[model samples]
Target: MAVVCSKADWFVTSCSTTLVALNRKQSGEPFVFDCSKAEKKPKESDGDNKSAGEGSEEKDSDRILAFAISASGKHVVLTDDHKRLVLFCTEPSWKCISTRWVVRRCTSLAFTQAEDEVFVADKSGDVYSFSILEPQKVGELKLGHLSMLLDVTLSPDDKYIITADRDEKIRVSFRRSPYNIQAFCLGHTEFVSSLLVPAGHPDWLLSGSGDGTVKVWHYETGRRLHSVDLRKFGLDSENTEKRFAVSRIISSPDGQHVAVQCEGFPSVQLFAVDCGTEGLLNPADTLTLPLSPWDVTFDSQNQLWVLLESEDMNVLLYQHFEQHWRLCDSECPELKRITDALQTQWHLFKDSVELESRFKHLYKVNFDNMASYLQKKQERLDMENKKRAAANGTKPNKKSKTESGAVPHSTS
Candidate 1:
């Protein structure tokens, strides 16, 4: 079994047979839940309305909350708490291809564009590159960072590997036979949270830091290009609170819009970068997603996918989020049902002395104008859901059929 504490005050656990979530005060007993309930249809009932046989367990149930896409975009990699990595497809028909186990905690993972190789980093600052086709170690890079590797990305040409460290450094190295250090990019004074290699940009490297700044570097020359001080944009500076961890940074496939995911309230900011000046100008758009999002991913259709732990990594699409948010705000009786259950679960583990006051504080009480918003949102979502359900037959969700505004490409 694997357990993780969530920001929403719940403990999520998963085993071979089930995924369970427990309120922090639930006396350490987790309530069994089904992750697939949000998706697939239930099994047909028996003659007397009885349930069918047990459901299959999630293959990657014990994996950490991280996500990975394959080089050819055909497969994805998932790693569990036990240090075992599983390879699967990117589609809903996820089929595991292979699995490997490491001796230490897995820090980061990357797959080559060819889908032929896989790279994994461990807490010990050692990176191992292996062949996905052959499933054998091909190369290993050792850096003396002493801290855990935070993120890793392969250059567009697949000839170099870049890794961010907890020590606030970006290490660049060649990817071939004599994989040696190319250069070290340094600027941030705190831990580097993430690294991105924008597609079609061979010389550019993007790094986000715990110091509340996102820096762009000239990878080959190790020259600092642009520094975006997130503090100036209203990020919390307190070290104890996670307000601006720069959890994720991703470039749209076309290399036009770069989406940066930050901690605290879980908002995604889309930025337009000017390559001529090598700096970030302003955000083209911004979206406030559900709170305490564990992972965010963009699908092949450019639609965003969010994974939350309300009941075992709830996967909600970005388009459905506004309506989903509305439901939790007001109107929907389901909101009351969810909150009541959560409160009861919390009180079960909390000290009764201050339970009443704590319940009022923890439970969501923001209902001012929420009712009006939910009313409007319900209509909008009903129209949308019906339209999508019609074409999709209640299966995969459909994105907007009409084209959106053109995204201007950013030059290298």
Candidate 2:
């Protein structure tokens, strides 16, 4: 829901019907631009004759799907489910520079290395390029995959455009000449959900997928350098056929560490990037969380921010100090406010019946560990009580009471 700028000083987040920009250093009201208000007025037609309440409900359904901030942190772009793309300028003033309609709803967006052009990927398996310099022209068709795209990124030097799709394929194509196919990184067995070209190693690309593994690949040579099975950490007993997908993978801005999170697990695995090593990656640490995280990203300070998937939608911050990561007591007020607003909007828009149907399994009791935990706790309490009773010189009660003097004589 929020994308931090490469500089780490600014981030742009979609809050309800508005796109807001906040500075990491400053802490006042964020510059807000309401997308609902900025939307172009509908033309007069029979649709206008519909009930006002119905029209309002339709407008509220146009929620933002994807948003991105430029490397310079000055430009921002976001698209909603209504097939509208809006570009904004973060500096000087938070203002919508261009608002255009696209052919399909965008699944992801990224700013080119030059920051003059933006690439938008849609569910229809097409990518569109819109020029910020030439705002008058429409978005031009770019290369696309046959399957729906899940994520898109441009090489740091802007030579290749790498994209991940639902068909477990990561395609690297020439940015200038998209028709020319580069190489395909095809090891993933399921949908590739996330991709990243770390700042330190532009040649190597990191990806997370529905296969429950995070793989490092040489995008140019199509060689997989390393693969980590996340399932081993917390899903050893799960069915091998059932997917425990890696939902998000993010590298710190310094490129020294990468965070990997799975769909159902509440732990984030951290790996240190070793460009010189044969494996190219080493397990650095793991952060256990209270709830499964929906997304994770590092701030400008190299601290981690995790967005929770629960109904509260809490955003947690973890700071790295003394070579260890710990939860920060201080909070990002701006991020907190944005997430609160998002949760409210989510409740309003979410369909309870559909959600229940989709996540019925989650509601079911699967307390495989809870029973063991309670058993261990009871054992510990019993031991403590025995120690206390022994220290107080208390005798244990017997099932058979002494039968007066006859029982005492038999003992003698």
Candidate 1: list runs displaced more than 4 Å. Answer: 1-65, 89-93, 136-144, 177-179, 237-243, 279-281, 308-412
Model 1: per-residue Cα lDDT over 1-412, one tens digit each: 1222232233333333234354433343345432323222223422211222222241223435343556445665555444455565434333456565554557678888777877887666777766678653434544435667778888878888888877787888877742478888998877787888875466788898766678888887788888877665545544544434677777655465566766554566666666566644455555665555544544333444454445422434443243221113333343233334444444222221121221122112346696677567656766777788879777535433231222456789
> Each candidate's lDDT (Cα)?
0.56, 0.72
Residue 95 in candidate 1 has what lDDT?
49
Task: Give candidate 2 regions above 4 Å deviation.
Answer: 1-7, 41-60, 235-241, 309-313, 331-412
Query: On a 0 to 1 TM-score scale, where does candidate 1 land against the true structure?
Result: 0.58
Q: Where's the lowest-lDDT run of ten residues in candidate 2?
A: 351-360
* Model 2 lDDT on a 0 to 1 scale: 0.72
Best candidate, lDDT:
2
